[model samples]
Target: MKQVVQNYKSGELAVLDVPVPGCKPGGVLVRTAYSLISTGTELMKVSEAGMSMLGKARSRPDQVAKVMQSVATNGMSATYRKVINQLDSYTPLGYSLCGVVEQVGPGIDDVAVGDLVACAGNEHALHAELNWVPKNLYARVPDGLAPQHAAFGTVGSIALQGVRRGEPQLGEVALVIGLGLIGQLVVQLLVASGARVIGVDPDPARCELAERLGAEACGDPASAAVENSVAEITGGLGVDQVYLAAGGGSNQPVELAARLSRDRGRVVDIGKCRLDLPWNAYYEKELDVRFSRSYGPGRYDPEYELEGRDYPIGYVRWTERRNLACFLDLLARDNVDVEPLVSHVADFGDAVKTYQRLKDGELKAVAVLFRYPEAVEEGEAEAPSVAVPAVRRGTSVPAPARSGRAPVRLAFVGAGNYATSMLLPHLAQRDGVELSTVVTTTALSATNAQRKFGFARATTDLDAVLGDPSVDAVFVVTRHSSHAELTRKALLAGKTVFVEKPLALTEEELAGVLAAVEESGNDRLQVGFNRRFAPLLQEARKQFGARTGPASLRYLVNAGRLQHGSWYLQQSTEGTRFAGEGGHFVDTASWLLDADPTSVYAVATPGNEDLQVVLDYPDGSTATLSYVTSGPSGFPKETLDLVADGRALRLDDFVRASVYGRKRWVSSRLPKARDKGQSAELAAFVKAVRTGGPMPVPLESLVATTAATLAVRTSLVSGAPVTLARGR
Candidate 1:
């Protein structure tokens, strides 16, 4: 399927053929009929993307601050690669659409496979032939409503929510500034509520359209006509409420709003416009300022949007989805007219040209819609495969062993920041290693990886990479929730698998991977536990030597706060912070103790932001791991110590190490850069694949460490030690 995408680095727009997104649980696969374009919001993004690097940085100071923080944390070289990769990739467009449900996923019962629905959300309601919309982001369209008009549901909801914020009373006069797409809708909604309306905008055509749609009067903001209309509507006072629905850098909208609003009247901002209020005017009137967040009450809450969780109607009278449904109802009843707002309708195939025309000012549109190809008849559409295909059962084929001289061909499933910055860089230019293919959900990310790392091919199909017999190893560097399942599939396909930790979020997932190994008779697996392979730590252990008594180890990981909107915080789906990251510390501790843990006990600070986990080995040795997110940013990320037989080994992050034995020894000097042993770990895995030798870490040890990491959650819940089952 083809989707509209734009390259942020070059500002190049294209309709690229990418893989059809799967219909996951809690959502429905929708075949788009029409998709609405936000001339105000999307055009701003397109314009910003076309700017130079410096211009882009100047446009988004918030993003620049994040880049600076990343540089301080990961160093300049790593930050540069991450930033470049993000900027060069293609991002999707469009957030409002009307579509027929092609297939229903699990947990979706409100709408069926043939339902016509209006979808909202930039991530879900994209300008493609198909979309996967979660339950909370889509509402069923009313009977007899055209799909093109239903495409206005999302934007109409924005207008409806803004009007609700103003609390406009019957017979009250309201002023709506900036007669764009949303402003026009707001004008009609206010009039429908029995409130007289005055509209303001510089565009004479838009102002005319607003008046046609029920505004009492309309004119340009610079003209005295707007002020005169507002005063006349409110009997020489001012309008009772003001809705600012404009978008631009100019502060004229807010100033005009303050000038036209009655004393102590409400002011609602419904669009992304400048908010430089005229302080004295607003202060003297004591205007009640309110912001109508995109859609409504549940806009940014992941639980409400992605997890199918709904707020109680009593407490939250109108959520984003409810607003969407209400707007569609109003459209169906002919209370809100959208026909005048339809400025243009372009074919989906010409999406790139359409965007270019809009950006270059060749197209003047208040609202544009992309008409997709006709949908198939009801009951004809079959459910597509899920995002990740299930691991086939009863597989027993073993991969062909490779000669030592043969290059170990690798195909990567995810090209995220960690994979590009730390893993791929180590293997990209290495001899006797082949970067065969890079597969990602987005076509441009795969293409970016191929361009940067010399991959032989790039694609969005996971099956193609897994089915290829030439690929020797598959790197499962995706999100934590997928590691186990992807690893299981690769193992069943008879390919060596290297997955990043934590290996599995639950015991069931861990059992699933082990079951795959048993079914396929293949155990070539390596989890990313690179910290144990650090040269500094190894030297310290060598100097400390074998101990007569059980050793005590302590590992401190300053796992700081995640940035806002990070997927890591999607704990409902991705698992907890500790569940996803604790395996690294557990594996490192187990490696230092030279044994798998027998039991695990854990505790956390209030709210579970920080955790302390204790693991016990069979030989009476114990290791304590401290994972803290509230630590100071400047503090070292990781520090460890091992003590036994009157000897102590200390590691300061990965930069230096020391052993306090009979004859004291320390690492020569601090290294120029920190090496967490990613390169060495990759080398070991490749060598094992090439030579058909045992994995760098034993399968049993890997399983045990994963079990220990998972047990932390159980211990935290049960408030007792969770004993590990031995002899897997």
Candidate 2:
């Protein structure tokens, strides 16, 4: 399906043909009829993308801090590659759309196929012909409501949520600061709720439009008439509540809201702007200040969004999905009219230029809508697929193709951040390895990976790579949920497979992968436990290899808190950081001790805090991992301490190691790069594939490490120590 995406590096907009995403459990696949472009939100993204690197940094200090942190932890070169990868990636746009449900994924019971639904969620309801929206992010449109107007449901929900925060009651007077698309909707909602409304904005046209939509009065925030209009509308008293729905970098909206609100009244900010309110303004008035999050209550809860969990109506009356449904009901009942707010309507194919026009001020539109062609006889939208020329995001090398030597050819299925940053660069440097094909979901990434890493060809079809007999290996760096299926497919296709950590999320998937490994003759699968091959760890192993006593290992991981809606928190995709990241430490400890863990126990603090996991080995050895997200940022992310045979060793963030016993010595930094074992692991896997040697790590160890990691989650939930069933 064709989707509109923006290139962050160059701020180039393009409608490119991307693979139709598969419907996962707890979601419904929708064929988009109409999707609305958020002028305030999308325009900011466009403006940010168009800025220079310095401008970008100034605009987003939070991201700059993250980059600095990356530089501190991963060194300059690795952080540079990660930042470049992010800049070159394509970011999809649009968060609200009305569509026909084409398919329903498993575990979703709310909507059926053929239902007309309005989809929300920026990550789900993108401006694409087809989208997979979670059950909680989509609602069935009310009967007789036009799909075009239903596309406004998400924005309407935002407006409704802001009004809800304002808490306007009958006979109350409220001020809506910013008469943009949301402000207009807010006006209608407040008026319908029996509240007299005054709309404020700098644009006269928007003010007039708000007045036409039943706002008691409208005025420019910069004009003295704004305060006069509010006083007049409220009979010389300020508005009972001020809803700031404006979008800009100015702090005036906040100041205006504070001034226009009556004493002890409420001011709710629903927009993205500078919030530097004067202390006296609120201090004297004793006003209440609150900010409304996007949509409603379930906006960022991964359990609510991805796992189909819902808050009871009695507990939480208006969730993000309920807000959408309520907005659709209002539209159908004629209480709210969004028809006049849509200033422009473009075909889905022209969405790129529409965004450009909107950003360049060539189009005077408040709400821009993109219309997809009606489904034809085949039940598919009639939108034409856009032909994007193949181009790599990174550097291009005119290297020669594979000669008669025919080195071990490798194919990479997912060219995401990890593959592009760590794996691909090292693979590019290897001698007897060939980057055969790059298969990614999007055309831009496929082309870029092919060009940058010298892949033979770039394609979106994973089957092409698996079917080719010439390809000797496949790397599965996609989502954790797909590791099992991809690895099984690659091994069955007679190719060596190297999958990233936490090999499979569930024991059932693990069993299937183990079956595949056994069928593939036992030397084809290698899990990414790169820390075992780190130069520092290798030297430490040499010191502790001959120890007769059980060693005590303590690993401290300062895994900073992930944002609420981050993909890492989405259990369906990444399955929490425990399954996603904790496996690395688990596997590393297993390799260092050279002993499989016999039991695992884990406990965590509430609200994204510290987690303590203990692993017990058969030789009475124990490894303790303290994973905390609330620690100071300056601390090293990973630190290791080991004690055995009257000796102690400390490894600080994998950069340096100091031994504290009779063999007192220290291994410090490498002259050029921090050797985190990524290069060494990749080289070992390639050599094994080429020389028919044993895999870098034994298959039994891979299975045991995965089983132990899975046991950690079980132990945390079961509140008991879980014993591993793997044989020694």
Candidate 3:
């Protein structure tokens, strides 16, 4: 139950008690035996995390650009909240580990429970007691290899990939320009390929270890005679290939590799060293230079790592997974010995101190391994999934467990920024509302949320929350990909459900959710379309109610563009903005017109921002939404203008409104804070739960809003208007 976590803001490391992760489909849960500490990569992360705000920005310019843009649009106050949320998060560490399978998820039959395997992948194979690893990121360890030795499989594959890039032939001579753990492994692998190897580093101990591990020769790069030594090792013809496997702030490794390589020789870089190359040094010799990607051919492909899709052996013989299997085979045959490379074996409980020593250079670790508690050979330890004991505020029992006028007991399946900042605060103070449980995938947040929000229990299991009799309704505020399934599950569990915007991403998922809602006879389902409830918008709607002519509304959203690698940009996880955040606008437009969108046409500039969508209604009214990212940052995020019967009302960020076409123009401003209608929305849901009344947002309206959003995406793809299917 203990996992290693680091605070990104302080770079503080600790071992914390956390709940075991649920087994997801296409993956297997494993109890860790030994996990290697990547000194080079992890130490850099620690140092960067400890940097000052300005320092951190200097280190990552792309992120700094995003922050500046956010400040431009949302003002300084709102953007600060977003930045703080990101910085204060607790992140897991380590990626190469050996473990025994504890549970197998659906579609994973290659390995079963109790099988010893080597696991890779940053999201999985973390330095924890238990991990959920995808099948492709795991390979069976050979019978006789020790857990400590097998844990080096991922690192060894990385070394193997660098050698493969060099294209070293049999009887060739290669120079490994770093005597670190990876450099030592590179030398041994080159020897296994029948090539004479030379290792170079500044540390004599590392050089000596490399020589002992099958390097024909070893030299310190700091030594003035190192270049001459390489020439002598290769019979005055220079090395046929050079593998630059050093990590430092200096560009010497790259310069040295280019100097020592023979004419037309290949130089493969696999380290975090400076990439500045001396063109003249290699151009004169006509040398070939290539940088080796981590592991091998399938490094960053989601289909290969997370989806269990393997490259055909005939087409790609040495994919990342295949390279893992090959390294284990070599270890089995005694071709590669990693025993001497391990400098320390620390207990998992003392991982924090071990990392401290490693970071401060107090411990010389070639490959430090964290040994876990003895794993059971039969069936692994049962993953912890029970609900945490309640922390009672008073002697009163929760409302769902009591009789008359009891408060509605609620459990939240996620604790994201929106739920924490917008929803929980209002619900916590509301009358007849009891916050029962809060669940998340990690521990620190769950514990933090429990203490901060006055929740009775914190857990990592959804089943525990769903099965609790004390819980009467569930809030689904997780990522978009999880909305449909989790909502369906809660409905089946006979609990009311309230999910955030964009009920479902696809038509099929929408249908499934609607079916589940029908099956829950008396229980209600509500999607968050909070804009319709905003006081300003509601007032505008009342004025439009008296008008008889067709209306035209224009919604402008200055949604800033996100940089690459942001979680929001990953459509599979977060869904497109149209299906995720745009639904709120669609619902607002439809609710104001009191008509279902009959057809939609859309177009967008590059990066899917600067979008223009037109929705046609059955009542002959039309709404135009211009979601532009290229707008100036000082502009309000959302601005709406509605025109009907020669009267026009303009709303600015839900904080101020102006009406035109009167004898004199009238304007009103909210007191403070833009009212996005979040409070009113939650109040409505609570009222319905207490009174057993109709769902706050009609199911048909939610469905129609989502259907229209999906139709916009379809229209953009086909470059034509997309008609909605009846009843969707």
Candidate 4:
């Protein structure tokens, strides 16, 4: 697909053709029609992060501390590369849009051919020719809503989410502090909700727009008269609530909210600004304080958003999607007009420039959207790889899912981190699974691969093993770019294969390899979405049962490793960390719940605390991916919570898992060592090969897992939520 991406290295936006994303399980492919450009969110990203290397260290001491810790664990070379590499990569932009479904993948239900939908999350809702959205985030547009207008549905929902949190009752007086796009929408929503409202901003034009939206406009919030005006408007009692809409100001909003609020009034904050609040003033008034994180309680949870399972639609009918529907309803009814606020509209090619205008203060607008081409296209390649290193993994066990014995012989191609650190070790101990041959590009890597884990033989030539009549199945574990190539060659030779995360670099590659599998007529191609075998995850899945109703999961991954550095630094190689490591966590939750993910919207807290991605599954379960780094090492890479069956289950890393709740919290620890999943995952792969009844994880599930990772990448580059397919 032709999409616009920003070159993080030079702060330039480039429009290029990219491979069409493979349809993941429970996802729908959408051909994008209109995608909005969120200036506020895109500005800092299109430009440099504004912190020089030294300045970054000075301002982000916490980040520096984390880097130092990484250095301590991974050594200086790894740490230094992590620091320098990301500073030079490119990022994508845009998160909300309207598109038509072209195709739907396995397990998709709600959406079908020719469905007109608005994408809910970022990343997946790119300003591109095409998009792949999960089922949860895919909201069917009413017949009358225009695609262009519905594109603003996400923005309206974002603005409305804050308003929803404000919960302004009838006759309440509300002051919307910011006049930006979201703030503008907030003002209009407050007015429609029966609240007497005042909109604050330095820009006269925005204030004018607010006035048009039925809100009283005010100048500087810090001015004394503004407070008097609010007091007088409210019969000398001050407004009943405050929405900190205005951004960039310091303690003034907090200070002003305290002054403008009536007794026991509420303060709802949704902007990205530091708040220096007056504790005494607010404490004395007993003001109710609330911070609105995107769409409130259901915002970051997977069960509610992706799996088509939602909280009681009665209590929360207008979820972020519902809110989008609501806002679109208003627009469709002509209750509000967003045209006046849209100051600029440009081709997708100009997406970067639009963001530059926002950052440089050249163009002023409440909303600006990028227009992508009508068809999918590819973008420029960054230093095309002379030879993308091969990655692979394999075993002598074949069709274990249908059979109970190992295959004729085993061979492995492409050994990298996953092999060196994970699969190889597990294979060494897997009963009935023999690692007969290993392949790496270099003699040193091959020798190490062979000796470290006791492979029968190792060689630099991948074909040597593939050509061996003794070899039946081959394991591939190289970089993403080489996965399709190596797997295609191996499978073409009728070899059963167990690949790692992200089956291929692009959909085209995946199709080619899948075709190879089909040509080989072998149904034993397995992707290493290892979490399917993590005993703790299995227990969590079993405990959650089927999501007959609402199911929720809380996953906190101290994915402390790979903050930067390594080839993972290159987007073209491993994509982003989300696609590489984070995909495993996402796929695991999806597999357990077996729900189609509908919508994905994630917000990366500026200044990097790893990427905190919240996926919404159709089954009412939320996979809260807390990518936390720093603090300490050996922090049990992951912890999980499945809050269902009238109780919450906890899994501390893979080693320990338990259920809690009973007036006091109870913790359960699985009796296993830290590196526990490896053995089981390898064993399961062997089992799948031997039986072949069903790949432990279906090819559909493997694809979905990788797609989720790519969706996160879409979000990070685009700074928005990505939508996956709906019905599985």
lDDT of 4 by residue, 1-728 (tens): 68877655455577788899888887899988678877666664454355455654664467789999999999999988887787566566777897789999898877788877888776677877887887767688877665666788788778887887788899888998888878878877887789888877776656655665567646666566577779778998988888987555377778878988889989998886667878899999999988887744457777766665666787866676677667778877756666445555556766656666677778665777564455123221111111211122223334323234444356878777777887777667666767799888888888888888888998888777878866757888888778878888887776778887667765457567756655566556787777667766666556545545566777877765343235664442344446566767877777656764555655453223356777777656777777765436766677777776576777777765565544334336544466445667777666655655456666655655655655554444333456664222
Question: Is 1 or 3 the stronger prediction by TM-score?
Answer: 1
Q: Per-prediction count of colliding residue pairs?
A: 0, 2, 1, 96
What C-alpha lDDT does candidate 3 achieve relative to the native structure? 0.80
Sorting all predicted structures by lDDT, with the top scorer first, yields 1, 2, 3, 4
What RMSD does model 3 have? Answer: 24.8
- In the range 441-542, model 2's lDDT, one tens digit per residue, is 899999999889999989999988999988888999998878889898887677778998768886668777756655554347788889989988889778
**Model 4's TM-score against the true structure:** 0.50
lDDT scores of the candidates, listed in order? 0.85, 0.82, 0.80, 0.68
Candidate 1 RMSD computed on C-alpha atoms after optimal superposition onto the true structure: 24.4
Candidate 1 vs candidate 4: the lDDT winner is 1
Clashes of 3: 1
**lDDT leader:** 1
Which 10 consecutive residues of model 3 have the lowest summed lDDT?
382-391
TM-scores of the models, in the given order? 0.52, 0.52, 0.51, 0.50
For model 1, residues 269-317, the per-residue Cα lDDT tens digits are 9988888888999999999999999899999999999998999999999
What is the Å distance of residue 420 in model 3 from its true position?
Answer: 81
lDDT of 1 at 363: 79
